[model samples]
Target: MTNLPKIGKPATNALNTINITTLEQVAQLDEHNLAKLHGMGPKAIGILKEALLEQGLSFSQLDEDLKNVKFTVLGDLKCDNAPKRRIIRDIVIASIVGDEKCLTEWLTDDLV
Candidate 1:
């Protein structure tokens, strides 16, 4: 399994303050609900989004990557504010390119 990003104190505190702790909970929140939290500003939301991306996860795309299977970020090609779509595209490209093994190695490398 991929290592989940460390939820920093600020983010954790913000989540606790808003009573959101699990991935499922994060997945359930809409932008409006997230914006309602005390310390979860736009920047914090972006950080959380990045964390999810690093784990090959997103609120809407979580179902695509099953826990029983392994996956990795072969590439992250997207402009700003479109991480979810970028992930989806990259995953599709990975499948088509048949580079899952290389992706797994790259992801396992600490340099990546």
Candidate 2:
């Protein structure tokens, strides 16, 4: 992702006055504190908020109540002792032919 433009002197002074620096700091500012800063009225604050959302990272503390994640593979029968060299050769052929079904079936089988 692209970096945010450096906050200019005016913006920096405004942020420092309100005790904000990083995007995380800006994310935590409430409207009341934001409004008090020079050159940081509603429109500027809205722009900053939009930039944060675009980056897909948030400054909010994560919830401890969130569940742990686990991963599992599903759907296939498999040979217990398949030959890796043969499988690799089949995959190459299937890929060259653009054989989706063959490729999927081969991949879904457990790799030996």
Number of the predicted model whose lDDT against the real structure is largest: 1
Give stretches of model 2 more than 4 Å off: 1-8, 57-112
Expressed as tens digits, the lDDT of each residue in 33-94 for candidate 1 is 46555566777777667866666666544333333334323222434468756656655666
Write the residue-wise lDDT of candidate 2 on 4-43 in tens digits.
Answer: 4355567667776545556765655554445556676566
Clashing pairs in 2: none
Q: How many residue pairs clash in each candidate at the backbone level?
A: 0, 0
Q: What is the C-alpha lDDT of each candidate?
A: 0.57, 0.56
Error of 1 at 44 (Å): 1.0
Root-mean-square deviation of Cα positions for candidate 2 versus the true structure, in angstroms: 18.2
What is the TM-score of each predicted model, taking all chains together? 0.39, 0.38
Q: TM-score: which candidate is best?
A: 1
